[model samples]
Target: MKAYLILEDGSMYEGKSVGADKNVVSEIVFNTSMTGYLEVLTDPSYAGQAVVMTYPLIGNYGVCYDDKESNRPWVDAFIVRELSEFASNFRNEDSVQNLLKSNNIPCISGIDTRDLTKRLREYGTMNGMIVCESSFDMAQITQRINEYRVKGVVKKTSTEKIYTLPGNKKRVVLMDFGAKKSIAKELQKRGCEVIVVPYDTCAADIINLRPDGIMLSNGPGDPKENTAIIKEIKKLYDTDIPIFAICLGHQLMALATGADTYKLKYGHRGGNHPVKDLETGRTYISSQNHGYAVDESTLDKNVCVPAFINVNDSTNEGLRYINKNIFTVQYHPEASPGPGDSSYLFDKFMKMMED
Candidate 1:
């Protein structure tokens, strides 16, 4: 069926509907990754937003079960420049269309996704709607776009209750800030007994568990708004157990340590951000999302910044605790839907546990 996307700004693009026959409206954003579309679709971080793939041809390899970052697709909608019909990969068990159809997600293809990406870059991400071309109404579409809500995104995506993966190697407690399942899988792969707690779990409760380490997971929303978590992290700061964080987690860690964070006018929301490691002078291309970052100037007097700024935007990407076994990165080391350049951080966490 003929489909068209109507942005809040009244800009429209025509396309073909490839998945379920339904209208979808969401805050539209874009990703620059050339591959890993399945992982991107399934990641909880993309919840409540429609994702536009910058790469012209998508679904060339089809969808495979093993590539999922979460239990199911969380994105509100999917858009691409072209939709590959043929399933080419050896592990392909489901076509991309079938995958989205099964999940009841609305998808639009055969559009100028590059143009959409350009608009997002220029105007920052904004709410939009994918509708049947025959039913388009500018006023209704704009009203729907304005009504889109991206708040409380973490709660909508997080697990309803506690869950556990059995392991005895090391007890790791993860604060679920809309965490992807891959984070749990990574800990399980390391033989760590992973206990995933709710985002609002008290510091005393976590300490009572006597975990070998604690992990602050990536989530949606401004880090400064989560005041309780900041207070909680402060109580754990002096603990001897190793503490590691990622993305939003990293921002919260900085806040908990008396640092401040600020929102970017046009935030980093793509997969190709380049980050440098100040300790080793090594640079790695990283995947990132979120609109706010810790202000390096507000760091504690003795605190040290371990990660250099993103080369393109000069935003903070990593930090370390002075004389303490604590650190965090403003990128995805689990990298369920992007490059694995920073995966070594996982091994570093393991080594920290050993020490």
Candidate 2:
């Protein structure tokens, strides 16, 4: 079937519809990763956006449910240049088309992804719509695209109740603002019991659990919209528990500590980005997928200092709090579809809890 992609700027492209035959309007962003489409599809951080893959071809390796970061796909739509029809990997359990169709996700293929990516990079990400219907009013669609915004996605994706994973060592309370599963898996790998809690859980309730440490998880939407959760995180900062945060968690911690965050012109959403640690002076290949960054200049040097910065844009990547057992990184150290260069950050958290 035929499909059309309409951007808020009035740019449109015609393509072949591949997945669920329906219409969807969402914030459109692009990921530069050449592979790991499965990981991108399942990442909760993409909750409020439709992802555009810059790679020329996708579904080359097929789908593996085990590779999913969440219980289900969170992206509103998937856009690609071409969809592979063959599965070449031994681990392939199903085709990517089947996965998207089964999940009722709208997708468009055979579009000029290189041009689309260029537009996103040059103009920044914007709201767009994927329409399967050949007949539609352009004015109304553009209006919908213009008025669309990604909000309250953390609540929509967070766990409704506390979930526990048993372990033999230190207890960690993970604040799930739409967390990726690997965050808890990393803690479990280090012999820590993980208690994943909702975004709205108060600091007193978390303290009542008597955890030795805390984890702030990655999520979607603007960081400033979460004022209540920010207050709770502020309370978490006052405690002695060691805390490690990733992505949105990293941004939230910055807000709690009197720092500010702003949206990137064209966000980092790929695996090959370079990040340099300020203290060690070493650079590492990091996997990142966020459109917002913490403003390092707003930080109080005595309270917290920038620990890492993106090598390409010089934006804040990580932070270290003085006289506190707290650290946060804007990239995914869990390394779900990216590199393992920064995975050692998890060990640092474990050591802090032990101390």
Candidate 3:
């Protein structure tokens, strides 16, 4: 069915609506990944937003049950330039259309996604609406987009209760603010006993678990919104246990360590970003998706800059404690739907645990 995408800034684009035939209003952001649409759709980090895939041809690899980052689709809606009609992978269990249809997530295809991406790149992320067969009144959609509320996304995506992933090696306590399961898999794969807790978990409660290490997890929203978590992290900072974080966790670490954070004009959301290690001058292609970044000036002078300069924009990418075992990356080291270039960071975490 024919559809119209109206932005809060009074911009409008027409396209064909696929999947669930319903209207959606969410923060519209574009991703540059050529693959992993399924992972993007299911990622809890995408919750409360509509995603526009910059890759022209999507769903060609088909959808597999095993590639899911979360239990279900968290995105408010999906936008694409093209939608594959046929499932084409060996492990294909279903078509992308069927998966979104089954999950009640709306998608609009056949739009000029590249142009949309360019616009977002220039104007920054905006509230947008995907309406099916509605009267093409840009004013109404724009007003609706302006009225939408955008807070509490992280709480909505986070697990309501604590859970555990058992292992026999080093005891690791993970604070899951909508963390990807791949993180636990990495820790467990390295023989760590993983205990996954909810977002509201306290520092004393975690320390009482007698863990050898603490893992702050990735999730949605600005890190400054998580005041309690920042306080919790502050309480844990003086402890002797090792700490590791990724993405949102990285932001929280910065907040805990007296660093400031600010949102990017249009955040990094792709697999091909290059990050350079400041000390060693080594570079690694990374997978990233977050709008906020830690302010380097807020970092302690004694602290070392392990990773620096995201090639797309020279922003901070990683941080390591001055004389401690705490470390974090602003990009995904687990690399669920992307490259494994930064995966060695997990091994380094294991080394810290072993020590």
Q: Please identify model 3 stretches exceeding 4 Å from their true place.
A: 303-306
Best by TM-score: 2
* TM-score per candidate: 0.93, 0.99, 0.96
- Encode model 2's per-residue lDDT on 168-287: one tens digit a residue: 999999999998888899999999999999999999999999999999999998999999999999999999889999999999999999999999987999999999999999999999
- Candidate 3 residue pairs in backbone clash: none
Assess the local accuracy of residue 158 in candidate 3 as a C-alpha lDDT between 0 and 100: 79
Report clash pairs, candidate 2.
none
Give per-residue lDDT, candidate 3, residue 320: 78
Q: Candidates 2 and 3: which is better by TM-score?
A: 2
Considering lDDT, where higher is better, how would the candidates rank from best to worst?
Answer: 2, 3, 1
Report backbone clashes per prediction: 0, 0, 0
- Using alpha carbons, what is the TM-score of model 2? 0.99
Q: Write the per-residue lDDT of candidate 3 for residues 1-355, one digit (tens) a residue.
A: 8987888877788889888998889989888888888888888888778999999999888899898888898899999999989877799998999989999988899899988999999999988999987675666767789988567877888788877887888999999887887888899998889988888889999999999899988898888999988999988887888999899999998888788999889898888889998878989988888888988877776754546678768899988788878988899988877899988988888889889
